[model samples]
Target chain A: MADDQICPKCGAPLPADVAPGHCPKCLMQVGFESQDQAVADPAEAPTAVSGHSGVTWDLDQLASLFPELEIIKQVGIGGMGVVYQARQKQLDRFVAVKLVRPDLCDDPTFSERFTREARAMARLSHPAIINVFDFGQREQFYFFIMEFVDGTNLRQLMQSEGLDATQALAVVPQICEALQYAHDEGIVHRDIKPENILVDTKGRIKIADFGLAKLINPEATDFTLTGAKQVMGTPHYMAPEQLERPLEVDHRADIYSLGVVIYEMLTGELPLGRFSSPSEKVQIDVRLDEVVLRALQKEPEKRYQQVSGIKTDIEAVSASPTGHSPRQSVVPPTVRQAFNNLQYPGYGLYCVVNC
Target chain B: MDDAGFPSPHSGRFATTRWSIVQAAGVQATPNSRHALEELCATYWYPLYAYVRRRGYQADDAQDLTQSFVLSLLERNAVQRADPDRGRFRSFLLGSLNKFLSDETRKQGAQKRGGDRKILSINVDDVENRYQLEPTDDITPEAVFERRWALTVLDAALTRLQGDYERVGKLPLFEALRGHIGADKSTIPNREVAESLSMQEGAVKVAAHRLRQEYRDALRAEIAQTVTNSKELDDELTGLFQTLSGT
Candidate 1:
């Protein structure tokens, strides 16, 4: 029972657990039978931005709530709640306002916990982190006004145009810088996945929802809140310690999740039971395998003690000229400058070679 | 008329389905709508049972909970209480079941209240056997429910296709061509099937094409029964596909 058996009609791998006879992937394609006709109807096209939740607030209603800013439209809906792109009247600049789901606010201690974590998140000011400007409650809805990155998240980027090994290499180091900054501020982003990592049009990484997962659902073990298929945060990128010993989870857990994200970016599959390394799955530098494997170690103590260690290893591989072509060494100058400013003394030499 | 066992797209037979009828009634249940809701419950009960089991209940306890939950849904006319905006029976059922389980947990040991008052004829042993085959990985209970729900939709559609073939006395043809329903024509072994069915290779090709078209229709109709409009149908289809493909 090979899991990698690809379906003939649709090239997606046939799920191994599906009962034998019909390809589940093919059957899923059958489920999309009406999409062809549906796409033809222009009226149905704009429904993508509208919230899928049963209780959706119209633009007029949302506009009334925020008189200071102009509510443009709903941008996204996720586990925490809905995000609307807006413009600050005074600054005349675009910002994203995220309204926390009303159900999550039912807890009496929610506001107190929210303020504490939000203040900590607001303290984290980095080029790679989405900066939280302000947060407050109004009319039964708690909202966070934040800097808007005018580009798609990593998930959309991966889905729309698959990332190459070069693109992946360029992205991981930026993420490491962001994670290291947040860790120094004593903030651990429990939920670190592709969805939270936003890449601007300039190819700069801006990580969103820094500590919102813990603020929303304090009880990490409670899976019941994710009812009706509303994914609070995916467990695929979760480390073993996050699930097994949640009370003892620390910044090291974030390192483990980063390893999973790196694995998925390099190879388009999750690193599930006895999965192969990134180099084995793709045409990546073989030296990178030890970096990913070390970060993904089951024990937090066994993994990289700090996020900077992963960045140092990744930079070392990217700097080496043997495996990849010079074309692959096109590291964005902004990212290279950010790394040079860091405490890594020898990093400037690698930047000279790679850039 | 178009082909044996394949209905024309404009046949109007699928204009109304069980879910659409239930949704249209909207808190005012006609006998017809009630019966439609019951039929849907009967067909999709296994996923709910699997959800309960994955939620860390014993097989016996899970069976009892599922039976009671479905019984209560019909008896209380819970379809009327379903939020119309949700627009999908799958979400409503899962949401209601979660609420029911929470209520049941508060009244612990009240599992015997249903007391063999079975409304749906679910084979306990068969369901448990199927449950055992589920991948024992780190998937969430919601993930299990979602995957099972997707499988149930596909299984229902496949069953309906089989029924259509059986009614037209093309059961053997269906069994032969089922594997190639959504497969490439070049990949399908048309020559072997033509020899076995004592038909021309050209005829086998036509039959395989018709089977694929009919399957798409059957699956669309199956999904349409669960969603309210064409937009929601596409959304549900895409969502379920993502669930299965782990994208």
Candidate 2:
């Protein structure tokens, strides 16, 4: 009888006949979570343990996993690991460091591939490509450090609304330049969707996360990094060859994907079948019709053979005035068949987009 | 030192546990009330000791610094001024120790910090050997405090549970299943435990369940002492479990 009188929290004697829920002292203490205000008696506390089990799940464990880097905040999480906004204390530089999940690097072959790919990316120092600063092992996890871009990815920018025509024009040329630079280095960005492109606060467009998808299987990784959910629409942007014979895809695959990105940016709709050119969807300069169509060709060999060619065509298109009709181009039968072979449920995606 | 000299905390006087004692005693602690205050210091001081050591102070300096800080706390009656309803006692102690450490630095290092050279008896000679056993990874002061407090609670729960099992003459049963406590079903063959404890495999599983339930109860009681309310107990335990699993 005396035991019922004591407070469970502070261990003080409970004031006789106080209301059941509020711990007049402590639960009423914090203007914290609303649950504290409600006073659901913890009398069934143990039965609640099963639901509360994941409380230990968080990125706070990164303190030891990465000792050199003080994680400022989590920038984003992907299949590989997590991208943390960190201060490299030894260097005193703010960096966007991406740490892959330990499970992803469990294979020795994949580890070697990661190193080789990261090394190739590290050497690529282009103003239009996200500058890879350093990369190596940090405990059981492998990390890639790059210059943190202070901006949103193109997918977020376009998804929120749509980009202005000139803004879209400004972004695509730099993307062409970055892909051209990567192609010159013999590193093809296998996944070159709009999600991989970033536009910084200054409107400086830079291609982001190249060589990531090729080094590791996107299906086996985090949804955040693989863009798996958003990538339901990936088939809409993927080149035909990349979809049909993925292993044989080369740098031209990037050009094909970039064309899809440009097509979507101008129209706010994907460049699926029965679709008009970029100029038809929105009033963009008409000269872009051939440049975008050629890049969207059914075969990689037929698409602009090099990104430099795409860059040249984009620059030429930019020079021409707006409001003119693009010359007629024949519709290819193979491009539609290739679109279905993309292995994504993009039919629903385009249905939603078109509707 | 072990808590043997103090009154058993679980003996119904837990109504006068550290937090309640501070609230009951108020700011003007009398000569008679010093016993409860000392008991409070006895149960909680080690976590603070571990904290000072982690702040990069060497053995002798950390000991002297902690001893002096505790002495200074007693001299100032910092506990009496603590608002019992505001937060957990563990948080209050940590806050006070942090303030003391910051103030001590401003006043300069280890110079006669022991007020009137009072003997607090922290057993720092064994502290370094114990500290060396802690995980040697980069951790912030805040994390170290949380970790040490959680560890203290776990250790206390374990010791109390071990005592309970011993008193029941089931010490062997407790020890045989101790290793299996952290093991999953696949890792722990109920067969091995059954054969060793000389019982049916089903009884062994039941014994494991009982031990686990008892351990959970001990842990809850242990956690209940330091926190302000029952709601905060799980949050504190979660913090502890996270630290223990970090390695």
Candidate 3:
């Protein structure tokens, strides 16, 4: 049989041997197989672009390489690849599998870095971190199997149900525990956000996607400059030092991120920089704005020294007599006012800061 | 979208025909029909086996007797013998099974003859592997069987859906939706499935509807695979419904 050419649906280059219809990635389904039924007019041929990247791999192929895994569902298109909800057949449990971008694998160095990080991330065993179990390549697409968390991330959680002080306090320790573990391993988690924190059943927190973590090694100073520092993390959470000087930053940068997480947890708003912006910041209440401002301090030395320290501070404010009442499910009006005062107007005074 | 798409009476909460066919097919077939018989035996095997084991047979003896009893039913069309108008298919199948067990025990010395023809090919090892011994003697065979059957059908439905998704190349979407299917979201009061799938609420609802329909179709197809004739298919389906309802 002749090699299949022309997009199955649109007469463009068909990526591989997919059935003759619309492109699989795009929802286009026409042309190719039987030309008699084809619409010959070029003007009428649907020009719908592929909604998803042209990255597809067979499940059976994946199952062969990762014997323990059974591909469950495709989760979403990520920055680098497509994600799948898979089951570890040997363990009889569910997991999420991320298939790295096929084209990126052609770059040997990038592929090596990606797989090495995935392997290192899989070695990390922590309850709060999304667990990576295994990694392999199947049909040119590199795949990583991770614990399949059955819950929404903090972003969606906050969107529908605004964070409360008790709930906020509850989440801080878990995030810290995860960061502490990763930091101890000498891996600095560059991205920390509500979107990355997955809360599973029983409200257990699991931090996901160590895709941007920087593995520190003094022997490899050049490694930091090689694709590690360029536009890497969420701009809002990046430590100011990372922005100003990327190569010199270290694990403390992650602690700064954890501070931002706690700040968002308390005030329901991301800490502002001299240049922080989110389209929907107005909806966020700066209830504990004073606490948040201190965490977002531009200098790393000025920010909370440790994730544990930040967790302790959040716990202290949560336990304060004049602050939010322990019995109240929602933060009271007086607390909201005090928080706003700390944040608004020409005033710079905040929650009687000691540092 | 309509009721037809819904499981028919043959496919609904109570199905006598399905039970009859299973009961009949179980008893009639010989050794090669073992796999086919094993497959048919899945829905009802545990219950029957548990009951026989509880009735004071040794583990291996219980298994053999259960298989033998099922073979008898197949040879005799024991399911076709079910009169749902007189009593429910659940009662009829259990009662018929009881009668078969008693007759087999009484004719203890008779040669155990099985059918020469094969009905379907089943993975006997997989079927046998699924059964587990009761943890305690306090539980009745009937109760054990009922619970195992319930678990088995759910597992079968899930397996069938998984297979269909893999074949169609939409396994990922199916995986994400599987957790939400038949789940109680009361604890998560504001939780909307659309957020997980990254779709709007309307789209999620449509996706759920299609999933439920496809699941039903897969289930019917699974039930259909276990029988021989169209009438038997209808019968087995009705039995499956009753099994679902615990009637």
Candidate 4:
């Protein structure tokens, strides 16, 4: 601040020769001897700024941040933060902890938003969703402690050996089960691609990274808002409505994206442009065309109004037990009838029918 | 750049944020979107002008070149070459301005600036008056530009703070307490400000604390408009202080 004789307010080190008080840089008051001083509101500033600037945390800092957990191993990093697979000392259970990056820890809005996402995830009790073991702001970073599914994601599984129609029928319905619960609870997993769907070594389906999209959506929303004019998603899997009308995205957007996933899983292809139906891609039931096409519809209204609708159809297809031939007329008459007589949504009957 | 899929640095505030919008607009500003670019041009033209002047152009020539350079930059659609994601606005702007100067140098003589548009309303005498405040004979034009740019941004934040207080009918409070916006107040007791504002000493302390928080947020938001990524934010801030100190 040697030049701060310039003007601390504008970073303007205006000439010491200028008419003493006016900030030449921004044209504001400067250099006045007013006795008023600013006080720091300790409550508002969550962390002491002096301690917030390490590019990465040392192991000691991590240990100190979560004294209860043993920082076991680094899991993976996403567009948002780093994930570590740690053991919860008291529970003696392994959990995946995602920590917001050091640079972002200083942003109050981001911290608040992270807390909101954690709160949203905490509200759901579904087993299919990644369970929140613990979450809070500590030290400088916000960490989400989640149930670490000790299984490969569906993306890895698909890479090793693509899911067959029957296998997809088993897995996708489970995904639908998770999404249905989240959607019913007024949550939308805006980014629903194969990458987000994780499969355990034991064939358990866990929807990992629920609120990770909110922070990452900064990039996507930027593109959507700016000239890139591109929507943020695997374009092949994104619902057309998402790109065409971004702000109007709702729960159905998830359903539409899930439909794309089903199409990818069943046919090993995205439902892009006059895409051949899943049955056409492989030897699956033609009735699935009705379900997949409906879910992948360009119009939001034309798609499954509820995620349970897709779950119900997939469950019905799986339940038919091969060659039942539940009528080629697969398109349901109404949104209500599509999920007709489905009580309690995708929780019980959906799982039982698929199981 | 790790295993789970975290993109480096996260770009933090958002691309939909003001600076991002300006970056996007700079790339391909349509007639309709040109206003956003112009607004940015208006805010930053001063530093670039100061940079040109310090580079040894006479006052009239500097003003003419700066206006023409900014207009021609947009008019010729040259700034569209900058990738907002890959670079910072200040760097991109200074680089472009430097290029413009070198090009102008080669061409020689004053280039004709259009009188039709007046895109950046730079008051010549006011700018010249402001230019007089810059220390002489020690800093490079680049360093001067950086210093001025930092000050301009700081000024924007201060102006915003002033406007906020003015809007809330607390301009006097802002004027009275503005001197110690971030400085230690131990020398000047809270009793002094309390006496002036006619409030309790404790209330003055609370008010001062809130002002500090508000000013910090304002500064952050202002700096946010300059940097696109969280990584660049720290660098820009460090550079801001260094440039101001004429480093």
Candidate whose TM-score is highest:
1
Q: Write the per-residue lDDT of candidate 1 for residues B159-222, one digit (tens) a residue.
A: 9989766754568888889877766567888889988987666456656755675677678778
Clashes of 3: 33
Q: Could you estimate the TM-score for every candidate?
A: 0.48, 0.45, 0.44, 0.44
Per-candidate DockQ vs. reference: 0.11, 0.02, 0.01, 0.04
What is model 3's C-alpha RMSD? Answer: 20.5
lDDT of 4 by residue, A1-355 (tens): 2455645455545576434444443231221121111012121111112222434454556778889988764544443466776778898877888886555455457766777878888888898998887788886677888888765556545543457778888887789889888988888887787767876645778897774554544344544454332233434455655555556678888888788788888877655545665654567776687888788766689878988888788888878755523333333455324333222122222122122
Flag regions of model 3 displaced more than 4 Å.
Answer: A1-54, A57-68, A211-230, A272-290, A324-355, B1-247
Tens-place lDDT digits, model 3, residues B32-142: 444443455555666666676667776656665666666665555455565645333345656877776677453363224432222223334444444443334376667
Task: After superposing candidate 2 on the true structure, give the runs of residues whose Cα lies further than 4 Å from its correct spot.
Answer: A1-57, A218-234, A324-355, B1-247
- Stretches > 4 Å off in candidate 4: A1-54, A57-61, A102-108, A218-234, A321-355, B1-247
Candidate 2 local lDDT, A123-201, one digit each (tens): 8889988888888886566778889875556765664335777768777778888888889889888777666677664
User: lDDT of all predictions, in order shown?
Assistant: 0.73, 0.60, 0.52, 0.63
B33-105 per-residue lDDT for model 2 (tens digits): 4565565566666777778888888777677777777666666677765766656777788887888788846
What is residue A179's positional error in candidate 2, in angstroms?
Answer: 1.0
RMSD, every candidate, angstroms: 20.9, 24.0, 20.5, 24.7
lDDT of 1 by residue, A271-344 (tens): 76566655556666666667877777777898899999999998888888456423233344543343233231
Question: How accurate locally is residue A139 in candidate 4, as Cα lDDT from 0 to 100?
Answer: 67
